[model samples]
Target: MAKILVLYYSSYGHVEQLANAVAEGARAGGASVVDIKRVPETVPEQVAKNAHFKLEQSAPVATVADLEQYHAIVVGTPTRYGRMSSQMAAFLDQTGGLWARGAFNGKVGAAFTSTATQHGGQEQTLFSVIANLLHFGMIIVGLPYSHAGQMSVTEIVGGSPYGASTIAAGDGSRQPTEIDLAGARHQGELVAKTAVRLFG
Candidate 1:
């Protein structure tokens, strides 16, 4: 049974929604186990803002050991000033030990993100995530244009040829559109399937 890790940091729940969709897709693609973990909030107010989900208590803080058990990893984060959030950046930075040991060598990695606007650097965020994976010697995967929904522009609401993403409205009231969810799921499935092919 292959395991895939869905790790993310969400300040407003938008990225959490994307992470759930990605996990659903990965499970559908036959990953026997899916580990969903969230980065811990360093500030009390930030934790309070996310009280609805109790993310502070329920979202496990991922460690380098947690990363090693998975055959594939899908990282998610909210777009922060055209990049991944500082929380995620800090988490990735701690992977220096893993990088030194080539702990992620040949493993499959994918990225997902949510932004407050349509052009809020979702692609850039995904790229930044992929860049770290590259440093760790991981194989990065992205959504392919051949997926059924990919051919339909209506299904292209979020995510891209590079990775998954969501256009989270500024107010954070608008949920991800069906297309956005579908694209995210598809990206997860792609990553899972690729991991199986490469590592199984």
Candidate 2:
């Protein structure tokens, strides 16, 4: 069995919901332990309190050192100007030691994200995260084309071969749909199964 880590930084609640779905899928895929963690919030307290959504959900903060304990890691973030949120980017920026030591060389890595609009840089944000994972020499496990939901033409869903995602709407009024969560779950399962095969 493989130990998988699903770490993310969600401001409003969309990414958090998707993160849970992803974690559940990872466990369903036979990972022995699925630890869901969050990168610390860096915004001002007052600013965060006035956000359009609540931070009702949270998880333990993740440290770079913890990466060594998991065979697979799934990262999630909300898009910021067609890129990953500053919080997630900052968290990942601290992995110099891990990178220096090749701590994640053989681990499976994947990413998921949420954007404020349909074209709010979803692919770019996911690719940015994947780029960092590659810097650590980790094996990239993307959402495969076999996930039929990724090709849905009728529904407004979020996901691609790069990873999973959801549209959050510009005003933060939108929440993740079942289709979005399903895509996230599928990505998690794929990464988990890959981890079991390669690292278990």
Candidate 1 residue lDDT tens string, 1-200: 67899999987778888889999999888787888898766557755665543354456777766888888999999898889888899888887777788889999999999898878899899999999888888889898775455456643367778887777787777778777788889988888788878766
Lowest-scoring 10 consecutive residues by lDDT in candidate 2?
A: 50-59
Please give the lDDT score at residue 128 for candidate 1: 91
Q: Give the TM-score of candidate 2.
A: 0.96
lDDT tens string, model 2, 12-118? 88889899999989988989899999988888778888774455576888887887888899999999998899999888998898788888998899999999888
TM-score of each: 0.90, 0.96
**Each candidate: what lDDT?**
0.82, 0.88
Best by TM-score: 2
Model 2: runs farther than 4 Å from truth? none
